[model samples]
Target: MASPAGTTARHGDICVGLMSGTSADAIDAAVVGITGAGATARLELLGFGTMPLPPEVRRELFLVFDQAERAVERLCSLNVVLGELFADAARTACRQAGVPLAQVFVIGSHGQTVWHQPERDSTVPISTPSTLQIGEPAVIAERTGVPVMANFRAADIAAGGQGAPLVPYFDWVTLRHPERSRAVQNIGGIANVTYLPAGGDIEDVRAFDTGPGNALIDGVVTLLTGGTATFDADGRLAAQGSIDEGLLARLLADPYLNRPPPKTTGRERYGLPLCRRLLEETGLPEGALADPAAPFSLRQRALDLVATVTAFTARSIAEVYRRWLPPIDEVIVSGGGSRNPALLSMLRAALDPVPVVTLEAYGIDSKAKEAMAFALPAHDGLLGLPTNVPGTTGARRQVILGTLTPPTGIVPRSQGKEGQV
Candidate 1:
């Protein structure tokens, strides 16, 4: 059931955070016990787990990502479909933590983003800056009987912000250092970095999308395997092959890489379409990619392509640091890309002398960082606090981020439940 307006969570209340990144690989859920609010907020991870998206659901999500081309009905049905899946994720996290559903104070869901156009189209007169992340909060609330906080981006966009890199709020609250400048780098389907100046306040934070992360590499792998494989698998293929310097150089030339901060990009720019173009440019025939028994020469070419894309992802991040970010004492890496050794090796080479480490070194799960971040914002929103950081997101002013959907208090006897880079 909905709490009275303005009523907030008591100290040590359990909260759940749900996230489905651009990879759309799985729903990451974290059940956390939160105390305090805003910068003083403290979060204790009770339990965390991931539930992979079903193949069919992932297929539909890609179609929708095609944007303005898919049928309206598909988008409509997917909204509720994702909501149910999200609810399941929340419940799973609680169960894993041995916490009852009734004990949860709220659920914060960063719903799957199908489209994000934070700026208006120059070619289309009617286009406006808008964003959409669709896993209906009402459905989540009804299913779990817990108040839900969602749509964390729209408010900032409406305030003339990029409405992205919102995780910096989390970075600021929990990861800031007193004596060391740090770049909290996350490499999901897209790579982004948050620079925290040593001992600086929230206004000193800086962040932006660097370029393609695992998306291009994952796209190529999926295409070459004819959907049998979706990623480079710890970058084994990339490690075996060689980088195509020409393709890598061409990818580095992307304007988005040079675009100023407060900018973001998604599948619309780096998705499967770019994967096909890169393959065509490399002269790899479609027939060879779909064949398991391809000639040794063609197989080598596939590996080379993966290596090149991984290099591109790493170089893009290093390039951004050189061009925009201040000198950093260290870089704390997180997200799916951190698992790729080849990608990490390339990143280390690109930024020599800068210590690069993972969140795990600091006693946090890299995969769970983003999901846990949202738990704080949900906690703040319930306390009627603003969570957006103007310096990072370019918002006109500080603004509270989510729209609250009060719980329906329904516990069903049975339920049926069911992204791209």
Candidate 2:
């Protein structure tokens, strides 16, 4: 294993960034090159890849994650399974990139988040304002033979922060420009934005969850289609259904949409139960809603749900910009939500004259953006630099995020495998 270098060292390094967002779809692994230090941080994207969870695994994981009460043994068992899966994804990315596992310096895995309760107190079952991201770093390291840096959010929460919107640090590094104020909006299972002012200091950055990215849409689609569909692909269903204006208004009335910055939420608040409640309140359904049910024709209802969720996400982001930041020059979007034409159309409509661009326009793949974000923090961890932005995570003070898992042994390399070819 490689040992941590002294603070003054400045050597080129390669780090693998792994992330499984709120959607719980797959693990995104990105290889990034880090150079320079401190205020002069520089990043280069070497390669990237995504390994999806099997449909059954995804369903089981989501069930355990969304349910309030789950068997402790099952949760613990899944943690190890997830770790192995994460390692497999990382190794697969390495093979595709033609990079040797031994050559890579660090692996930064965001892990799979089962639950995030940042509002908890002493009396709560889980102590403190805690968050849980399984997939042990030790398993990743053992499988890949590389030092792994996991659990990036715990330190931030410990410092009185929300432990989310951590991507803003990377957004600041990758998108901050002297000429324009740019907003890097990621529409994942939940939508969030990182606002970088034109020529702004670190303190000027703003980030927060914009609510319900693909979460609600996916929920409705699954419920309506009887698990035959995971989502409303390309907004086809939504395009076929008319927006139920009354339900849309009711759905948008949730207090989360109106909350200020530095907030975070997940399936705990916006999952199937909430969707069912919304339907009931609108006098739409009774009894258990089954997929592929006749008479009610959930297809149209599902479409309406997708359209409304997309619209809500876009409108909330636009509202945030209008309220907190300066005139937005461009909105750079990324993640699975970006692929949804209906969502993008709604976003453009909501933002009006502001114009939206995908992260691809700036040379960052939308699916890999969050993984790359972890790379930035991992780089900071290795360098002893503060990774959290006080303005974004609500941390009392700036702190370097993540732990360093140094390489265990130096493996002698063959002639053809040594160094970057």
Candidate 3:
């Protein structure tokens, strides 16, 4: 296919996007074609694939990430493993699409973030805003022989941005309908939403984290089931359990729930320990807290946690819109959370009066949304164009968002006028 006019392409740009979100379950790889400009850019999804993390690897990663005394050497080793896994995924995606490795112009990898402390400052050696994502780009580049764009968050942080909810730029580009006020809500490890007002300017668009998503519910499931299950699959567990109103209220009282936009959060604030603490604080019994312990067994506790966590996500999103957004027309959901029927039901009930839809309804696959978002930013970086939305990320000014890791013997091409390379 010939590259579209005014679209940045040096012999046509075929880029692969890789993302392993806060959930730590799997890595999503997508091949995309970048064409056109801001608000008009067209992202063609050529192919997509997912590589599941080995069970043992997932457990080790959870332990190292959730605990405080993680060894440095182990963390270092996992970085390479993750890089190779990502490279393998990229290669698989290319093969599926029938695109040669060398033909791909770049790869945008949102590496596995082990920790994110957005509040970190000079005095605090490790605090918020100090985030670390694994999977070495050099390894990916060397393995795939394609230029890799990784560690995308650090640059946004360097420019004084929160380095999160970066997908809003993509959401705005792909989901903004001319006649409808739209909101793109992604349910990953943490839930976040980007609000695109009907007929609103780019400056008017808003995005922020909307509290816990599958992370807390997943953690609770693991604890209650003794690792038999990784998450409240299909929301089946949650469907049986009753929402402990008191516990639900307590979880919703978190300050993060009431925070304003331009904010972000991760597993650090809503992981396993926090879930255990919530349970302990609520004084729930070790066994089934409800009368029917058998049916609800592990399932009940998982559902209870899902109810509280998913409720928090829904209410937090509503709070953002109530406080900042003007009359939104519809809510479009994406990510793993969208698949949980129970959670979706809860969200629909909570967000009543306002319609709730999936990003797939608008022609974007829910699971592949985040990967596609990173692809847009990588495309922007390649063109030396600003990618971060200053209003949303809190950056001092607009700036291109990533460092380019070129393949051996290949030179970085310049973006000509009209954004063509």
**Candidate 2, 366: how far from true, in Å?**
1.1
- Across 1-421, the per-residue lDDT of candidate 3 in tens digits comes to 2224533353246778999998898999998886665676788888899999888778778878866365577788889999899999999998998777756767899989998877766786555666789988888888998878888888788889888768888888887877999878898989888888887777877888888888888877676665667787788777777777777777677888667768889898889889788667655543333334456354455456656766666666666667766777899999898999988888888778999998888888888889888877877677667777877878777777777777675545533434422
Q: Which segments of model 1 are wrong by more than 4 Å?
A: 1-11, 67-70, 287-290, 408-421
Per-model TM against the reference: 0.93, 0.89, 0.90
Q: Which candidate wins on TM-score?
A: 1
Q: Write down the TM-score for model 2.
A: 0.89
Cα lDDT tens digits for candidate 2, 1-421: 3324431133356678999988788899998766664457787777899888988778778768766366566678778989899999889887888677866767888999888886766666657677888887888989998877778888899899989878888888778999899888998888888889999888999888877888878776666566667777998877676677776776667788777778888888877777666656644442223434545565456556656666766676777677666678999999898998888888898888988988889877887788878877876675567888879878898887876554474422212223210
**Model 1, residue 143: C-alpha shift (Å):** 0.7
Backbone clashes in model 2, listed as residue pairs: 1-407, 1-408, 1-409, 2-407
lDDT by residue for model 1 (295-387), tens: 899989988998999999999999999999989999999999999999999999988999899889988899889899888788677677888
| Best lDDT among the predictions, by candidate number | 1
User: Which stretch of 10 consecutive residues in model 2 shows the poorest summed lDDT?
Assistant: 412-421
TM-score of 3: 0.90
Q: What's the lDDT of the predicted structure labeled candidate 2?
A: 0.77
Q: Is candidate 1 or candidate 2 better by TM-score?
A: 1
- Any residue pairs clashing in model 1, and if so which? none
The per-residue C-alpha lDDT of model 1 at residue 204 equals 91
